[model samples]
Target: MYWTERILSEAETRNSGTESLSEGMRVIIGGATYTFSEGILRQERLCREEQEQTKEAFGFKWKKRDTYESPSVKRAHREWLLKRYFGGESSEIASLLHGRENFLDAGCGSGFSSLLLFGDHLASVRYLGVDISNAVDVAQQRFAEKGLPAEFLQADLTDLPFRGPVFDVIFSEGVLHHTNSTENAVSYLAGLLRRGGMFLFYVYNKKGPVREFVDDYVRDHIRSMSDQEAWDALMPLTRLGAALGRLQVEVNVPEALPFLGIPKGRIDIQRLFYWYVMKAYYRPDWTDEEMNHVNFDWYRPSNCWRQTPEDVTRWCAEVGLRIRKMDVEDAGITVVAEKV
Candidate 1:
């Protein structure tokens, strides 16, 4: 079925007991005609100022989308996604996605992550990309350029248009934490899943006390910066990370510092500083611009919330989701859960 008909059919099911939402109304978005309703338009406008800042930050990040599409970068991200969320096997990933009827890329930016993880299987499911930023326009264009059939919508995740267990699979990566409340966002999205449907997501994990403090301090300093200014300001930090990484030095911690969340083991100096102090993302093989992109993503956004493993488990349970798998890393927590 066409995107319009599919969306409207779901909308109709959601609004069944109420009056129809302006039946026959049509709207053009990203050069495609889509059925729209007054309710959708109203909800689209109900965004907070911070969310707008986030939208602008990521809008800038994703508009420079070419940086993320390089083959090496795509491969790295695909391997991470597969290993962390899908049990590290292409067949396992396929089993979860291929037969699903509806798949949502929640907080999808430029649709690159979706393409990286499951572009091959998009044909088997009705794909929908949602974001608050104008990156939806970029996503629509990219998918079109690839001759892939998908729909994109610009909307806030906190208050989405569709209602009541309408999606079969929802994938959100490193995005919910950028919302007003990560827990609230998780609850809302989990409620959109049908029984037995799956929800896969990644969220920043709460770092050590000193690291958390530095992260918040830097965010405060840069929250007022324009997107370009913020990007420029982050270059020094990125370069610092690169320089430290090149030192090729390792330190052995003789004992653990429980108070600081430092574990006893062999650690790289760059990683020690990054994990215990502030974020200076380093990838020795990547360009300075690419490393800066990672740093800006961490410090520029105003709503980057980090949670504990306990927090993630509690949030999923509160929303009727049973955790099927979870992976914890120094960078974040990854989860694959199903609606009970």
Candidate 2:
């Protein structure tokens, strides 16, 4: 079915009327004419102060549409997603997503990562992308440009429009931590999954003391800056990462420093800082804009929360989700779980 009809039929409440528009469709809600243009349905969401700030921050970040869409970066993201969420095989994605009735890209931003991970399989499912920011519009445009069919909604995580147990698969990548409460976000989204449905997500991991301190230190200064200001202010740190990466140095830790969460191993000098100090994302082949994008993503947002693996496991169990797969990395935790 077309997305317009699907939206009207699946919505929890009935609307007064809907009309076909040049771009997409329009529906009347409480005497207000809201347009679902280019597959994006705009909605008003009541948001907390921090959530509002985060929404604006990401909206600004993603508007730079093509910054991070390079082939290499896309390849890296696809590889990571496949490894962490789909048992390290691209073929596994078909089995996991095929024949699913409904798929939710919760917190989808510009549909970039979703396009990277699920572009090939989107045709097999009914896809809905939701974000708290204007990124929803960008997501719609991007999907349309690719000739892919999708429905998008601009809504907050705290107040989604969908009824419970409505989706068969949900994917939220690096988004839960940016909400008002990560734990609450987890439970609420899980409640939307039907029995035996899959919930795949990635969240920031709690880092060592010094790293956490540096992250907060940078965030405190950047939080008040305008998006452009913050982006420029973070260039030095990105440069630091590049410089360190160029050094091509490695450090050997003879003894594990349990107190600092440093394991005994041969670690790259750049990784030591990136993982344990502050986030200075580095990739030699990436452009300066691409590197700055990563830094801005980490520090510009006002609500980046970090959690331990235990916290994640408990959150899943508390929400009636059984862990099917989980991958732990220095950057964050990735989990693929199913509703019990």
Candidate 3:
């Protein structure tokens, strides 16, 4: 049956009043019965819980124990941005900001990225962050305590509440691919961007058939696991990544393999292993808990989608966006585009 037809049928079934659509009540939709608000609420709760767990595991500083405008806090934010962005080229992200008059941080979790990007320029830029989970609350509190000028809303990416093209820039990193439909989310975000405004985002790359299979196999089994259980289960995989990084072995390829994007040169085994065998690169600064957080991030999400460069380019073209730059790395594909 068509999707709209299925929705109508489900609506008709619900109208029969077999089950009321209450907070915990069940509703049938598209021939599938699911707890109405409860299911969504539970998912939101789980998402928030898992995020907090991972953040704690990753040793993220939640509260600002120091002074509100302490230089230490600023320093910490800078260090985080450098580490998160590959090649420590976070300046490139900042360089994309032509006009900091207004900005939107789509899916801003705990507002850390916003802090790193515009913490100093908060008084000048009208920054707004929207997230689906209760992390918005955490973000709001953080901003409030710091006396930063920013706004946050708890909303879904598929249906952003705002209207018209009012934003100068929209930044969403490691967010769209986690949604139900990355393409739809991109289109929605594009509509919110003013003409000539930039839309910067990162989406998971289609790494290859084998890596795809491994990722799917692991995620399928762990999606339903509890936070602690997922952490425990991923421990071994994280260890393997750590062990590989410790090997410190280097090899030189005789010829360049253009198809696989491998250049003829000396390469570190740990880095190569992370790009091929597994993706659990260990950082000396990260604790064991942080490593588990990395693994959990990989296996806990149910809607992780990997798209190719062609898919990203096509989507941008469909949305009337002109690609500025596209960076492909081991982590994912980062695209900076401007609405045309």
Largest lDDT belongs to which candidate?
Answer: 2
Model 3, 1-340: lDDT tens per residue? 1212322343424434543335554434333343334112112222334334333321222232231234544565466445544346765555656464678888887777667755666556677776766566667777888888776644555554344776788888778887767898899899989998988888988774455667788877776667567768888888887777777889897898656655688888777666654566476545555666556666666668888889999999999999877887666888878899
Q: Report the backbone clash tally of model 2.
A: 0
Off by over 4 Å in 1: 1-3, 6-46
User: What's the TM for model 1?
Assistant: 0.89
lDDT of 2: 0.84
Of models 1 and 3, which has the larger lDDT? 1
Residues 231-314, candidate 2, lDDT per residue (tens digit)? Answer: 999999899999999999999999998888788999999999988888999889888789999899999989999999999999
Residue 121: error of model 3 in Å?
2.0
Off by over 4 Å in 2: 1-39
For model 1, the local distance difference test gives: 0.82
- Writing each residue's lDDT as its tens digit, candidate 1 over 1-340 gives 3444545554533323544446535543323343444222213363687677888889899989756777777888889888998777878877887557788899988888888888768878888888888777788888889888887767777666565778999999999999999999999999889998999999999999999999999889988889999999989998998999999899999999989999999999999999999899887668888888889989988889999999999999988999999999989999999999
The lowest-lDDT stretch of 10 consecutive residues in candidate 2 is 12-21
Q: What is each predicted model's overall lDDT from 0 to 1?
A: 0.82, 0.84, 0.65
Q: How many pairs of residues collide in each model?
A: 0, 0, 0
